[model samples]
Target: MKEYLALFVIIAVFLYLTYTIASLPGSDGLPGNGGYISDEVWYVTSARNILHDFFKTPANSPYYTTTLDCLTNESRIVKEYVNINAVTVTGNVKCYIRRGFPYPDKEGILSYYNFEHPPLAKYVIGLMEAIHDEPLFWRIPSMVLGAATLILVFLSARRVTGNLWALAATALMIFDNTFRAMSGIAMLDIYLAFFTALLVYLHLSGRLLGVGTALGLAASVKYSGVFPLFGLAYLYGRRGVWGFVAVFLMAMSVFTLVNMPIAGQLGIQRWVHEILAAISWHTTSRPPGPIASNPLDWLCMHNSFALYTSPDIYASGTPAYLVALVYALYKRDDVSILYLSTYGGYWLVYLLGNHTLYSFYTTHFSPLAHILIARLLSDIARRK
Candidate 1:
């Protein structure tokens, strides 16, 4: 009990310091700098668009046909050839007359963003907008999820090893400057980390049904939820057909239930149509600049420091890094660290090929590294 209390106090202090450091003029704002990034602009617009159903407000709408239609269209002459500035069309344009985002009032302007990622993220942002109608409001939930991710790390570490290591793991995640920033922002990556850790915890604790439900929620947040699904499938590969079926049904049921309201309100086909429209926007979206076109461009760009660095920097060293890490922990094969590494590494591979990959993509890898680093630290302590 005394040890747990001490751990809690230490964690609380780190969290406070983290928040304080992040609050420094340029910290709390978001993706690129103190201000929100382009993706955040889209997320905010999408959230506002969702409110069009209830309030008819267009303040944050991403569509060109809304508040800024005239300007969005006029400026769109340049947007057309610019690639990154292209607009997306949605069924909501006709049904709600809500128009496109960012450049909401323009007719031909379209978003380069696509719905392929998953609708749940938009729904989350939208729900927050419904309440506060502010970007900061939408950011609140991700912050909570981020803090919860730390709590889960602590708990999971204790379960896998013991309390001492759990406290150390939690501390590492709290101080890891990048994770600190990502958790405070409104993006989906932190949420993805939260869900991945959650699903793993539930599965380890013998709550298979909870694992399915959690994964479904995770999938709804981002396409990366598929990584957790794969992890579970691999873990349960030989458990039995019935086990697989039960898990699948639980996950699918939760996913469908959450999506039902949106599908019903928009019409199932129209909902799917908007989703497809979003996907097309993303895939065809133009490269931001030459520096953004290649993964190596990350090195030269100085302003947005977060966008450039990540575990991929270690890819060339994977033979020495991941290989060594794997061999050293060979005895912990049944542990969650292995699964976290597997899923995180899998995403890193996909990101390497994505010419559009940004800094936040590294969030996908942090949760896994958080645990393993703690384990490594523990191993060193034991040797000492």
Candidate 2:
């Protein structure tokens, strides 16, 4: 009964927080299509374009695009073209009222110009786009998944310190600026965070296939997930090195399967090339821009990325929680060190030349850190 009550309170709290944030006077974009916070412009655009390229869907429905209407022979513009999605569209002036993403890229690469990352998350966004092609629709999937992930946090923490501490973990996650920001935006990190939380739960639950599948899905959302792929395999190495290789291959196979849609469109060879190019794109870095922060900056939640304004939705870690994590590590907490060590992967990326990283990347591990931190406190209370 108490567990049920705790769950109810958490759910109520989550709903209230989300409703309040969305009601805030933030950038609402143009009327009808909802707001474009942070990378929603890039990610949501890709999702809509993917819908058009893949299916020409939400066709002839009421959607809107800022992409100007093309003047035709009647307007005497002759042969002027508008470059959209980096593809030249000739004499194309479809009504943006199609209730789907923008028109497909002319080249049919179907990448929608955001081809560097894997497409599963975009496909997820596309699912919402198919329903109603708007920013709210694009964002709906993330919020739903974010809500679902709270359950994962609760269950994962239950394994650590039973129901009360599990509830504590969920509360911390709900309030964390980074998690909350990612949850509401239509971007890649929240999907990665969902898979990451699943990995943690599957890891604690000792489910083999679940771990492998979570690893693949996590990596598919962002390459940062690859860190946990190896981490989990090493944990499974207790079985044998061959078992480790097998687990790694199983996860990679799922990753390849996730990319099959791209291969189906681009052909197998081009798809392979695209995947390699994406890997290179991730590892390589450019000049440090204002938005980019080093991996270490995330430890104390410094250098937050502003996802939205008016009041500012800064993507950052919680300082008090991070301090708690460090103290747990000082006490030789194995779980603390295990989860925190994942930062070593980012440090390696930093050392191996990629200097421009973002603190928002902590979404990959922050939830797990919170759950384990809750368990640590729960343990202390029991000892006392």
Candidate 3:
């Protein structure tokens, strides 16, 4: 036990160091820069609003427009983008300030902050605001939690298989620039990714309640986390239908409780309406920006906008990711196979059913992908 504990600590420290190094200036995906997407600013703004005003309506909403002109409009808050109100430099690097919520009044184009997304991620940033009162401060928790996510991966992998495979998986995830950049930010991706991975790890290890709670928390971070619940259904189906329903309801209950109070009963009904709006906006809401082109072309060219644009538009057509998922499902006996299927399934369901896909949307499946890729490489090393 002591040996395992020590190993866990070492892995945790290594993940923290690696993330910190990768997160240094120029690593964050900033706008107008190669590899830097513009969505990070929006997430930072949302996070700030959650901290400052958890109850009030958002202003300067990069996600949805509640202005009188668009209030009745069926528009999806696809990008959840944040409008940076100001940008300043302390020494050599420049820092940005996004227009956040809890504004004094809703005037002049609703240019404060509004609901582009659910409140959980912003709630996280709100926590940061409570502590640091600075943009970078919100990022601190993400870095720490992101490192902790890696540790969970390492430990889970070791328990599922062994140290050799676990170590390999840990190293691969640690070095992946996408994972590093996502973790380095104040966005909900890292938090969602970590909890999603943690939920899967627990379920595979035979901890049912942990899976439920973890998944609930994951969903709370972002709706994307709901994908894994489907995987859980497959795993639990053999036991009995009741068990599956029980756990699912437990997970949903957690999701509902967190969101209900803020949204109110009418808010629940509005979620569906908002979802439709987001979906419609996703396909047709191109407002003549750098990202107005077709998503297929943008994604293929490795463009920054491709990574940051709302999923509503980018997901309009069938993507190759669906084919990959079908192939993955055929190999569903392996846990890695399940991960791939879920990851692929998640993309397909959203893409085919909805109108767009975003760069961070890829993050929805990253936790499963990380584990599968790590384990696959570990197997390769052994065969060699």
Candidate 4:
């Protein structure tokens, strides 16, 4: 009963926090006062275009260009065109771009949408748009996924540590400004983080099919999810190659399925070409301007990315992460080692690869960090 109560309270708190943050006023492409910007404009609109094309035409109809056009128009509008500018009495002007709306000029020059990231997340957001084309609706998925992630974090921690530690870890994550901010946005990173945490939890439980499904879903949300495969393989390879193969096949299948609508429209050869082009664009893309920081800076919390201003949310866990690192170093337990290795593998990719890295990218590291910190606290309490 005590354990159940703890879980219940944690979940209730998480849900409350997530919903509150997600409900904060933001513009979902509708023109209005007090409208806030979001990356959802691109994702929600692209999903809208894809769904529109998917329904209006047959399954094999060319949605590639349509999706690309939607993405391209959104990019151009947000970057090149500014629709609204507000001036303060002090003679300062703040500019706001119109987002989350379909492209008005059909004849405008449409650049090929990069289609750089995987499509699963956009599809989910698009589904929300289908239900209700509102900004709040678009962000619902993130809020739900964020809450689910907290549950998984608690479960994973409880499995290795205790209920008290699980509760502490969940609370730490729940209160994190970065987690709260991401939970409220229509962005891919939060989804990626949720699936990644689920993958770890499922893997730990020895549920092979669930592992594969989680792994597949994670990668489908964002390619960065592939990083966890290495850690999983290394930790579980002693069982044999069959499990790894299952993970591979399932992940590939999910990836292929989610992309089939767009791929079928483009044909195999053209689809391959588009994917390679996206890779090239990612590799060659310039540094992420002044606001961006390298992997080291993110881990050290030297320069966390600012996601919002009015409430002052940054993509950072800071001293909490530092605490986790110290505890992991001291404990060296199986759970600690597993998370440390997985966390290290994920960060190492960013460290070696050259792309605009944001602090939010560190969101994936939060669950492991929380678990480790919880373990440390649990250990100290036991010793006392």
Candidate 5:
């Protein structure tokens, strides 16, 4: 009875937090005045295009139409490509479409496709668009996934510490400005975070299959997820070598399936080429006015990325990260060691990467930080 009540309370809290996040002012997917970000325009547009293709000509339609030279910039371009307007070159990027228009859609389908990021996250956003083509609807998946992540954190912490510590960790996660802001947006990082947490929980629970599935799903959202597999390999060594192989095969299968529409249409060689192209773009391309920080500065929160300005939404996990780092070093137990090493491995990738360091990248470390903090607090209480 007590356990059931505790579970109920935790679930209730999660629901409340999710609702609060979902109800924020700019949760809707619009442009201008606390509307969707520039990246969201692409995500929502991609999703809408994919859905249109699936329903309109699922059997033989092309995965994506070529980028048509279109004129006029309006939200309507997100649904259809128009060639009836005058084209004017505005700037260096050569704007075929008017400013503020999310363009290049022909016949209610996207004119151009983004093979840069993995397709799974866009597919999710597309599903939401299919359900209800609204900003709130588009953000629903992130909200739900973010809430689910909290539940997983609570359960995992409960297993390691106790109800009190679990509650503490969960509360902190709930109030994390970065997590909350990302969850309320139509972005890919939240999905990555949720699957990463699920992978950790499944591994800790000794569910090899679940771990593989979670890992595959995580990677499908973003390539950054592959970092955790290294930690899994270290923890589950030769004794679990077969299971590790299973994880790899499962991850590859999921990756292939999620990308099948585009890959199948493009052919395997072309698909691989496009993927490499995306990687090259990231490595070489620089944002016109880059707002990025070095790894050390990002870690110290010297330069945090602002997700929102009016509402003052910035991603800063330095405080919790510092506390957790200290706790992990002091404890050095199996759980602490695992969490610390996994975090270090993930952080190292970002630290060494040549790409810009955005604040949301810290989402990968948020869950581990919460667990470490909870364990430290629980330990202190017991000693007292």
Candidate 6:
């Protein structure tokens, strides 16, 4: 009964926080049209385009007024395109409706706007856009998932730490500017964070199948989701080699299934090209920007990316929070291994190339870090 009450408290607090975030002046979609909150331009716009593509909303259709389809594949040249609000351009890089596919109906999975990233999160945003195509509507999924993420953090942490510790950690997570900022936006990292926390919850529940599914969902949001699989497989390996392999196979199957909507439309040739193109885009580095930061910078809580101004929301960390996460390695347990693999995954990507990582990406670590912090605090309290 007490636990149930605590969960209610968590929900209430998050509801208040999410509301506060949404009420910000520019919390809507693009700048000038509503306001700027960073990547909402890309993710929200891509989601709008995906909604139009999946439904074949024609160029002449009145539904296009919802501002869903941002890019029309009329021509390769920039001037020939109808760029809605120009959300697709980032520095010199441009997002296009790909393969010379003539817009909505003729589009394939790989030809959709922002096809550089996987489609699951966009599909989620697209589904919401169908309701009304408003800015807040596109962000609803992220807000709900963000709330679910905190609840998952509490539940998963409660298994290993005191209820007070779990509750406190969950509260602190929402207060975290980075996590909070991501939580209230129409962006991809919040989905990735939710799945990562769900993975931990399922892992603790000893449900290998659910763990695999969560991993697939996470990877579907961003390629970095694949990193935790290595840690999970190793932990499962302790049971047997086959446990490891089953987790891997199940995750692969789930990932393929998640992409089936897009992949089914791609045919054989475009699917192959997409696979290779995605790999190259993720691995390759381009011009350094102000928002980019290194893993070391993240740990030190230095140089956080400024996602928005005025009612400022910075995607960043404090030195102590990251230190607590690092300290958890002393536990030498499954959670520790998971944290190592997930954070190390980012470091590995940085080392291999891809210097454009933003501080907002830290959303993925918030769940694992909070759980670790709860345990650390619980241990300290007991020692005292």
Question: What TM-score would each prediction reach against the true structure?
Answer: 0.69, 0.84, 0.67, 0.80, 0.78, 0.84
* Two-way TM-score contest, 1 vs 4, winner: 4
lDDT, model 4, position 181:
75
Clash count for candidate 4 is 0
- CA lDDT of each prediction against the hidden true structure: 0.54, 0.68, 0.53, 0.66, 0.65, 0.72
Cα deviation of 137, candidate 2, in Å: 1.3
Between the candidate structures 3 and 5, which one is better when assessed by lDDT?
Answer: 5
Residue-level lDDT tens digits of model 1 in 105-171: 2223233232456667677766676555444565677667777887777776677667787677677
List ranges where model 6 is wrong by over 4 Å.
Answer: 25-36, 57-112
Model 5: per-residue Cα lDDT over 219-252, one tens digit each: 7877776767776676667576787788788878
Off by over 4 Å in 5: 1-34, 54-112, 238-240, 281-285, 288-290, 329-342, 345-355
lDDT of 2 by residue, 251-318 (tens): 88999898887688889888888878877777788775658888767776788887767676788777
Tens-place lDDT digits, model 3, residues 1-384: 654665566567656754553344332322332122245445655455544355443333232223223332333222222342222112221212222322211122223233545567767666655554443565677777777777777777676557766666666665444556666556677788788778877777787777788788887876667767666777788788876787787787787777774567446667667656644553343444443322333224233233323221121212223332443455464455556644655455455654344444544555565555455555567799
Candidate 6, run of 10 with poorest lDDT: 98-107
- Clash count per candidate: 30, 6, 23, 0, 6, 0
Between prediction 5 and prediction 6, which has the larger lDDT?
A: 6
**What value does the lDDT take at residue 79 in candidate 2?**
18
Better candidate number, 4 or 6, judged by lDDT: 6
Score residue 135 of candidate 2 by CA lDDT: 54
What lDDT, from 0 to 1, does candidate 4 have?
0.66
**Candidate 6 structure lDDT:** 0.72
